[model samples]
Target: MSESITVAGVSVDTRHWIGGRRVASAGTFTDHSPIDGSAVGEIARGGPDEAEAAVGAARDAFPGWAATPRAERARILHAVADGVEKRTEELAIVETTDNGALLRSHRRGVMPRVAHNFRFFADWLLRLDHEDFETRGHTNHVSWDPAGPCVLITPWNAPLMLATWKVAPALAAGNTVVLKPAEWSPLTASLLADIAAEAGLPAGVLNVVQGYGSEIGDALTSHPDVRRISFTGSVPTARRIAASAAANLTPLSLELGGKSPLLVFADADLDLAVDLAVEQYDNAGQVCLAATRLLVEEPVVEEFTRRFTEKASALRQGDPRDEGTDIGPTIHPRQLEKIDGFVQRALAAGARAVIGGHRKDGQYYAPTLLTDVAQDSEIVQEEVFGPVLTLQTFTGEDEAVRLADDTRFGLAATVATGDRERAERVTARLVAGTVWVNCFFVRDLQAPFGGSRQSGVGREGGTWSFDFYCDLKNTVTAPEGWDQDHG
Candidate 1:
């Protein structure tokens, strides 16, 4: 039961999950394992033609699916949750193998988070209110309507979890979706489609098109029939999508890249701070919220680095599927090269490599830390998206906030200080959308998640996502004695 499932009974080619069936297309793309650089699977590389088909499918199903009651949609989503629960182990295995994340994290952390997203949005559907009111001597009411067919583009890092964030809410809001998963990690997306189909979702409500970004992604974003576009990936890509959506003025929500930071004050708990530093770099620091820059107060810089390096050095890095592995290889060989270049550039600019500064095999890069990195260096200026963290020290709260805010990205940040007043003050000054006080990556289902500046344009998660996927329509009713003709 854990074997690879094929589309159209063909092997060695790309496949698409459309209308509850695994259908193969003429175009194909190769998918590789980041750890060993071996071919794991192939996905049907869709192009303009396939994009049209997928969009058409979603459009065809839109009216009926959007007309379905919220309660019925909730039942379908709950069934998806149940189906995911049934194949939890298999999904986890495929996810780890395909995405190069630790198996334990996928099974315990990400999987549960996906389930929680579904359940949370399911409940949100029941609680949504289209309330009536009186305003200016006139009866008024508000209604929320689905934006019809949505084009959802998910990234590779947390494919299923991120997809769930979009899919759950969009479905709950009564929208049909055409999901274009990142080509690098299509296994879990395919598997997720299977699970949803098994859960008895109506045909054409959800479709997965696997392909390169240029082909399928471009077509989907610019498609005339798509009412909205929801994307989670790089800022550059998000910008491109925005421009494309502008062609038709289609509504869009983007959760793009991040160059997040962590600030540790002199009075903070050094051990806890060190733990968080390591945790931020978990999964090779590929996360959008990873604290790539550690700004420590001058007095505690030495001790913090000592503890942080000790913890970073102890992280077990090897096969992602291994139960004992804490970190895994970068998701692609090109990603490793890019990270290496950043480290090399930082080193050339007079930064010191505190722990790891090299690469191994095809895509395996050790958990790395850098010290004395110049504020203007590429490592600090751009998002590394690897297992690398740069260290810098600040003399005071003002300087710390200045250094943290001195970036194009304002995604997430962490401040560790025992002084409540100081923490509040620093949090206010930090430009990031999500600021963690003395903690990192601890997210709640109900919390609004997104970033400021170049990090992203709109928010995901919370009730806000429902608002993002749907449009607001206000209605006004005349009083019983009101006469339109006389007026």
Candidate 2:
């Protein structure tokens, strides 16, 4: 590995991990922490050359990794999960330093989910049934043949946890990967490479190249050998990636931005709805699956707003490393500016800021809530991606469904209701990939997780992930007696 240094008491490698070794780039860039504009570390500035090298390494590793026994792959994945669990706090601190998310959340939820990603996918892969049914006296079997080298382009918001969401299944399905992590939070990805290596993952099985998207991202996505591609980012960036990947007709799984809704009915428990609304401020509302658009029924709208604003107003915005900090800075000052623009525009359009309406100190945007927002306002339609929420009221269930499905995004959503029939009726009409009845971000690894429409192009999680990472095939054979007689 490259020279190691300490940041937040965690040792992180600042060079590219290509071919299972530290590879220096011709240039370098310094990652500045958003918390206080501190220089976090010097990261490699990878370009087309580095992207090609990493892809080549993954390409070379694919055949052997695919041919290896399934059990060995699962074993190695479990070991990596163990490594992640052991270093949970260390990883959490590094992630907080790099991305400005709450260290407590990373430790309590994100890192454990990372470990769970690997373990769940590992065991799930081993349990896939490969055999067949007798039809017309003929046996038909299936196989999830490993695709060739793959490219995983992930976003910066949640860093390692999101990267592993793609990496775990890609590796477990036996495809070597070249992961290009978002430059803003690239540190933990290098650390993840170390974890996989220490867990006995074969060389060239997973590679990380860090650089600006303009420099190396297109090259990585458009490479000839990259058989499958998965990207999680903004729609504009996804468009650019789609254009580049179109040259080779590479299949893509795009999980883009969301302005997902959280619906609260009149009969819903007011405290529960308020708590879930406050939870959106988690990660400073950087979550792609966050229910940023809250649609509350008119009967309880006033009470709901009172409780939500009080709770949201009380959220502590401070150093992410502090266990009690409920909200942290946006990833960068530019992001803070973007978030502020949304709040300003909404206020100018006569919307009321019931809670926070400005940036806190350096990079932290206040946990702002917008009320009296028009259904078609730009703030309602656009994704602010900060500690912000928009509240709207509907008179009836039909209007609630209409308002919820009105966004261009359909990533994920939340529903707070007391009636089972109402929950079922509403969820069926809502166009999100995942919906929670009364909770927020409760993920089942085995469930199909993805978005619809502009939110994303395809799904991941469970067999959906395997279907993308592997080339599924079905083979049919003649009856055993007939084949033997012919032979």
Candidate 3:
């Protein structure tokens, strides 16, 4: 059910899928399941040479692939969606084993979204439009052209879903891709790449290279031949990748970090608000858009805190694969320790822990909730990337907007209020790219998804992804005798 692969016949160790083949290589790294801290398998450790080969394969495939009719490309995407559907169970198992995501979440949430992205982009390909402009005497046309050989760098948090957001559109727009999966969760990436090959994608159109970011990611980001780069990761890494991409002036799209806020008004559906807030922090707060900060109106702060803390305390934390577990371990031991330190520092700075805080082991930390944290504290200001929520109270709507916009990251914000006017006003003022009213984490494939400010640049999902993967060109022309006619 689980295996590695080698693309382009470059044999390597671990379970690496490369160029439509399963590869075993000498250099490998052990992959552990965060659920129980057990070894799942080893992943091939690709180096510069392998990365170059993968990129080269993409380059070689770009001309023919991009020349294919758009309808044909859409057919391929439809087939990909079908393959993913057929393997939903297998993919879900690998996803949970690799990243500690809940099996139900993968089956019910991630997979459906991934399939939707493919289907949505497939429709976009069929209806792609070009604009015609009539100058005084000549006709000008604007066309979107595929950027050749895209380098897709996906994160470990939601590997398959995030990769599909990029891969679906890039392929739909006729660009070949070389994907570098996060070193922490390479299994699903490898598996998905193999599935794409099996879905009848021509050799070299999609390639997966496995290794650490410093080695494989850096090589892919800086490679001169890679025409575009789409990356999803931390803000610092986004900056570095942007700098490297500057060498050739290659186009880049980034989906970086966030410290999103969830504002609860006095009139909000309190029960619903509390439930959504707790669910947002379910994945140990490893999600980029997790509502880690709760800004409640002063009048209802006490009641909201009571309900929120009670729900937070009731959350079950343990092995990710267990049916009863509501929260799982952090992706890595280092992340666990880092989150623990952040909570400790908040406590030292006069914050009150209303619920879980301490770590059970090196990998698992309780779903933590802290109140009375200073606005400037690291726990509130920086992205903890853990399941830690800090509560703050504001006096009025204006103050709520100000406090929510205070952060450097503007990825997402949620407002819980039944008043339509107030919701609209608060939503408009929030600096985040995505604003949710009375709901949280609900995304449609047809909607543009990305962040503002330090959260990220450019966008993904919907038609926006197709625009990001392609370049626009304008052509002005006349009839065969138009030059003389114009003169």
lDDT of 3 at 313: 81
Off by over 4 Å in 2: 480-487
Give the backbone clash total of model 1: 3
Model 1: lDDT of residue 2: 18
| lDDT (10s digit) by residue, model 3, range 1-487 | 2344332232223555555565555577777878777776667787787888888889999999999999888988898898889878778777887788887788888888888778889898888777687888678987778889999999999999999889999999999999888888887777677678877899889988888888778888899999999999998889889998999999988989899999999999999989988987777789999999999999888888889888888888777767788888889877787899999988888999888878886488888889988888889899999889989999889999999999899999999998999988889889988999988888877788889999999887766887889887789987456455564
- Per-prediction CA RMSD (Å): 3.2, 1.7, 3.6
- lDDT of all predictions, in order shown? 0.85, 0.91, 0.84
Instruction: Provide TM-scores for the models.
Output: 0.95, 0.97, 0.94
Best by lDDT: 2
lDDT of 2 by residue, 47-157 (tens): 999999999999899999999899999999999999999999899889889999988888888999999999999999989876588889888899999998889999999
Write the number of the candidate with greater lDDT, choosing between 2 and 3. Answer: 2
Worst 10 residues of 3 by lDDT: 4-13
Candidate 1 per-residue lDDT, tens place, 1-487, comes to 1125442132222467776566777756777877677777556778988889889989999899889988888888999998887777777777777788888988888888887777889899889876688887687777779989999999999989999989999988889999988888887788788778878888999999988888788899999999989898998888889989998999888777788889999999999999988897687888998888989999989889988888888888888888888888899877888999999888888889999988876688978889988788788999989988999999998899899999999999999999999999999999987999988888886788888998887787767888888887888987777566994
Ranking by lDDT, best first?
2, 1, 3
Q: For model 1, where is the 10-residue window of minimal lDDT?
A: 1-10
* TM-score ranking of the models: 2, 1, 3
- Identify the candidate with maximal TM-score: 2
Distance from true location, Cα of 79 in model 2, Å: 1.3
Report model 1's TM-score to 2 decimal places: 0.95
The better-scoring model by TM-score among 1 and 3 is 1
